[model samples]
Target: MKNWLNLTAVAASVALLVGCTNNPYTGEQQAGKVGVYGGLGAVAGAAIGAATSSKKDRTKGALIGAAVGGAAAGGYGAYVDNQEAKLRQTLLNSGVQVQRDGDNLILIMPGNITFASSSANITSSFHPTLDSLVLVFKEFNKNGINIVGHTDNTGSLQLNQNLSNHRALSVANYLTTKGIAGSRISAYGVGPNQPIASNANEAGRAQNRRVEITLLPPQQ
Candidate 1:
C-alpha cells in the first residue's frame, strides 16, 4: 500500500512535468488527453506495485488486472466488500483481532484460540468463528474461501511455511467436516512474505502472527 502511495506521487509528478511539454505523438498538442492518460497510468501503476513482485510482471499484470476488474460487477464488488467488512467487525466483536484488506481478512488469536508453535490443531476457543464462517459460506457461496496461515518472521522460513500450511489445512479440514465442499475452499501458508505488521516490535509481531481468509470472485 505504501508502495502504491509512492507510485501515485511519482505519477502525479510525471503528469505535472508532461503538462508543460508539447505533444510529440500528435501534431497539435493537447494537455487534456495527456492528463487523463497520466492519471490513469498512476492508478494502474499503484495497483501493479501492490500486487506484483517484479517490474515487468507488475506492468503486465496491472494492465490485465485492470481489464478484468472492469468486467467485474461494480455493485457486486461493493456488496461483497461491505459483507466482508461486516464479517470483520463481527469477528472483532467476538474478541478476535482482525485485519481487513479488501476481501482478505486476517485474524490473530492468542495461543489459547489456536495451536502451539508448529501444530495445526485449532483450539476449541476458535470454533465459534469457524462455525460462523460455515454459515457465512452457505449464505455467500459465490466466492471461494481461502485459508492462509502466517507466522512472525521469527522462525526458519521452511519451518514457518510448513507450520502455516498445516494450520491452514486444519481449518479447511474442519470446514469440510461442516459440509463445505473441498473444491470450494483452498488453503496456503504464506509464511513471512505477506506480513501485515512489522516483525520487529512485539505488538506488531503479535499482529504478524495470524491466519488469513481470502474470498475470491465467482468463476465463470
Candidate 2:
C-alpha cells in the first residue's frame, strides 16, 4: 500500500508538470513549478499527495496556467490575490522578502537572520517572526506551504543536503507547533542544487544559504 501511494504521488506530480502551460511573455514553461513542488523528495511528495488527494476546499487548477507573473483569473486567481495582499500587509518591514512569480507566492527568509552559521537550529530571535507568520497561515487556511531549504556550496554534497533538510524540517516543525497543520506543510532540503547567487564570496554565499516557504493553492 505504501508503495502504491508513492507511485500515485509521483504520477500525480508528473502529470501536473507535463500539463503546465507555456508563458509566452517569458518563454519559460510553467512546468518550472515542478522545481518548486516536485523536486521535494519522495517522502515529502507522498505526504503531500496523501494529504491533498482528497482535499476539495480550494481550486488546485488555479496554479496551472501560462504566464510568469501574470494576473490570476477566475475564482482561484482571486483567492491567490487575497492571500498575497494579506501576506504583503502582514510582513511589511519584517525583513523577509515576499515575491509573487507567476501564480505562486514565495517568502524568502535569509539565512543570516534565520539560522546560525552551518547549523539547522533556528536562532532564538527568529521565533517571533515565525509566530507572526503562523497567525497569517491560520487566517488564510486554504493554502499549502512548501518549505525549501538551500545551502551554499561550501560543504560536501551529503553534508549540505542533510543540513538543508534539517533546516526545512526545523521551520515546518516550528510552524506546526504554532498552529499550522502538519498535513498542510511539506519540507525539502535542496542543498546547493539551486542557488540564486555566486558561492565564491561571503555576500553571495549568505544570499544562497536561505529558506524559501512557498504558499501553494490547494490541490484537487
Candidate 3:
C-alpha cells in the first residue's frame, strides 16, 4: 500500500505540475482548473501526509481517495482552492487555525478556545467560529468532513479517549444542527495518542489538545 501510494504520488505530482497555469488576473501561480484528484494523490504529490496518525485517521486517506476519483481532478482542485480561500477569510481572528495542506484543508480548533479545561462542552464564545464554518459547509456541500478529536496525556487513557469521543461528537452534532448532513460527516477520538506538540509543558499540551476538521473535496 505504501509503495503504491508513493508511485501514485509521483505520477500525480507530474500531472499537477503539467496541469497548472499562471493566474492571468493576479499574475499568481495556481493549480489548473483540474489537478490530481485522489485522496492521498494530491497530498502525496505535495508530500503531505494525512492530518495525523490517529486510529480514526487509518481509513481517512483511503476513503478520501475513493471518494474523489481521478475523473474530477481539474475541477476538484479549483473547488478546494476557492473553499480554502473562503475558510481563511472566515476564520481570520476566530481562534481557529485554517491551513491548506496539499490540496486539502484543515481547521484546527484549539482546546483553549474550543472547550473549558477537562471538559468536552464547547465554550459559548466558540459558537461564532462554528457558525462561520457551518456557512461554508452549507455552501460547499460536496466535501467530506472528518472531525478528529485529540487531547493531552494528563488524564487516564480511557478517560481521555471518552472525552475525545464526546468532543468530536459535539462538533459533529453542532454542524448537523446548522444543516450539514450527518451522512457527510464522520467523527473520531484519538485521545492522547496523536499529539502534534510535546505533552511535557502547559503551552505544548494546550497545542496538543485540539479538534481537527479536515475537509476532503469530492472529486466532482
Candidate 4:
C-alpha cells in the first residue's frame, strides 16, 4: 500500500511539473496544450499501471507509463512549434501579430490591413498575405482554422454586429476560394463585445477592431 501511494505521488508530481513549465519559444508561463496533455497522460498512465500490474511491479509500470505519456506530449509540442516558426517568418513585418495560446496559434489581422473602414471587402494589398497563409494552411492541413471578427464600439450595436459578421464571412469565403476545405474552417463575429483593448482612444479602438484566425490542433 505504501509503495502504491508513493508511485501515485510521483505521477502527480510529474503532472504538476509539466503543467507549469515555461514555453520554449515565447519564454512565457503558459498552460500550453503540451502541458495539459502531458499532465493528463501522467495521471492516466498511473491509473492504468496500478490497475494492470502486479504489486511487486507497480512502481516500474507507473514509471514506464509516465514516460510514454510524456513522449506523446512532446511530439505534439514539436508539431506546433514548427508551425509557429513558419508563420512568424512568413508574416514578418506584415502588420499581423502571431500569438501563442496553449496549443493554438492566433493570427491577429488589424482592420487597417485587412479591410477598408466600415467595409466588408478585403483590401487588395492583403491578397498576397492571404495567399501566403493559404500555402501554409495547405501544408499544415491537419490543423483546424477558426476566424473571428471583432469591431470597436463606435457604431450602433446592430450595425457593428452585421459588419463584423460580414467581415468574418468575407474572409471565410476567400479562404474557401483558395482551396481550403470549408469543413476545416469555422468563422464567427463578436462585435465590440470581446475587446482586447479599451475603446477610449483611437489606438485602442484600432486594436479592438480586428480579425483573429486561430489554428487548432486535432484532438488526441
Candidate 5:
C-alpha cells in the first residue's frame, strides 16, 4: 500500500511540473503536447514499473520508468517546435498562415491566392510560395502531410465536393513534383461542410474557400 502511494505521488508530481509551460509564440502559459504526452507517459510507466518490479526495487523501477517515458515524449515536442520555427521564417509575408494545434502544424492557404475562382487549377503566382514550402518540407521530412480542401457553400453539395477534392489533389500533385514523397502525403476534401466562417457574405465565403496542409508527427 505504501509503495503504491509513493508511485502515485511521483507520477502526479512529474505531471504537474511538466504540464505547464510558456508558449513561445503567444508568451502565455499554455498546456501543450509536451505536458500531455509527458504526463501520460509518466503514469503508464509508473504503473508498468510497479507491476513488474520486486517490492524492494519498486520505487527505483518507477523512477527510472518515469524518466525514460518523459524524455521520449518530450523529444517529440522539441522536434515540432523546430519545424514550426522554420516554417514561420520561410513563409513570412508569403500570405500563408502557420497555426499550431498541439503538436500539429497547419498551413492555411487561401483559395484566392492558391487557385483560380471555382477552379482546381493553382494560380501561377502561388508557385513561388509553394516552392518555398517545398524547401522547408524537404528539410523536415519526418512529418506526414495532410492536404484538405474546403469550399464555400455557393453551389450544390455535389459540385462543391467534387471541386474541393480536385483542388486537394492538385496541391498534392504539386508537392509530389517538388520531391515530397508520395507516401508521406494524403489529400482529401470536406467541401463546405467545415467552413471556418459564415457563407452569408463574400468576406466570410472567401475565408471558407481554402486549402489546409497539416503536418503530423510520427506518433500522432
Candidate 6:
C-alpha cells in the first residue's frame, strides 16, 4: 500500500512538473517542478524501503529511473538541507532564537515577542528577526522555504493551527517586503503538534509558542 502511494505520488508529480509555467529570469524560462518533486518522492521511497524493508528491495527500487537519477535526487535533497544548516548559523548570528533538528531548523519566538494575548500579530521587537530572515533567504537563493507557525497547547487544535498559519504568513509577508518573492515562500501552521521543550512550565510554554522556518527545495 505504501509503495502504491509513492508510485501514485511520483506519477502525479511528473504530470505536475510537466505542466508548470515559469517566468523568465534574464529571459530564460524556468520549469521542471515535476522533476524536483519526483526526485523527492524517489528518495523518500528509497529511504523507507531501506530502513524498514530489505536492502535488496531498496537497491532495486533505486535503480528505477536510472542509476544516476537516484543520486541526483538524493544529492539535491542534501544540498537543500545544507542551506538550512547554514541558515541556522545566520539566524544565530543575527540574534534570532533558533534550534537545530537534524535537517529541520526551529525558530522559537516566545509568547512575549511573537504575538499578543491570543492574537497572531508579532511584537514590534520581533521585526528584526523577520528582517534578518529576509536577508538570509535572499542570500540563500537556490532553494525555496516553508514557514510553519506553532503555538503553545493552550487552545483548540484547529484554532491554534489557524493562528499558526497566520503568524507564518505574517513572516512570509515581511520577507516579501524585503525583496523576496512571495512565490518563493510556502507557509503553513501545524498548531501544537511539534514542541521542542516541555509545556508544563512557563519557560517551556514560552518555547512552545514559536514559528519554524524550513528552507525547502523548490516545490517540485
Candidate that would win on lDDT: 5
Runs in model 3 lying further than 4 Å from the true structure: 1-72
Tens-digit per-residue lDDT, 1-220, candidate 4? 5676576567656655665757677898876555566666666776677668888888787777766765676567767877988999999999999999878999999999999999999999999999999999998888989999999999899999989999999999999999999999999899999999999999999999999999998842
The positional error of residue 63 in candidate 3, measured at the CA in angstroms, is: 31
What would the TM-scores of all predictions be?
A: 0.58, 0.66, 0.70, 0.81, 0.85, 0.55
Q: Each model's C-alpha lDDT? A: 0.66, 0.74, 0.77, 0.85, 0.86, 0.65
Native-to-model Cα distance after best TM-score fit, residue 85 in candidate 6, in Å = 7.3
Pairwise lDDT winner, candidates 3 and 5: 5
Local accuracy of candidate 3 as per-residue lDDT tens digits, 75-161: 566687788879988999888888877667899999899999889898989998898899999999898899999999996999999
Q: State which candidate, 2 or 3, has the greater TM-score.
A: 3
Among all windows of 10 consecutive residues in model 5, the one with the lowest summed lDDT is 8-17
Clashing pairs in 5: none
Q: Number of clashes in model 6?
A: 1
By TM-score, the best candidate is 5
Candidate 3: RMSD over Cα atoms?
11.4
Counting clashing residue pairs in each candidate, in order, gives 0, 1, 5, 0, 0, 1
Model 5, runs deviating above 4 Å = 1-36
> lDDT by residue for model 2 over 70-89, one digit each (tens)?
22223355566578778888
What digit string (tens of lDDT, one per residue) describes model 6 on residues 1-220?
A: 4663455455445533553545545555554443554455555655554455455565455335332344456455456555655666666754456654433455655656667877877788778767766776777675566788888888788888888889888877877878998777788888889888897887888888877776654553
In Å, residue 196's CA in model 3 sits off its true spot by: 0.4
Q: Clashes in model 6: which pairs?
A: 17-34
C-alpha lDDT of residue 92 in model 5: 95
Instruction: Give lDDT for model 6.
Output: 0.65
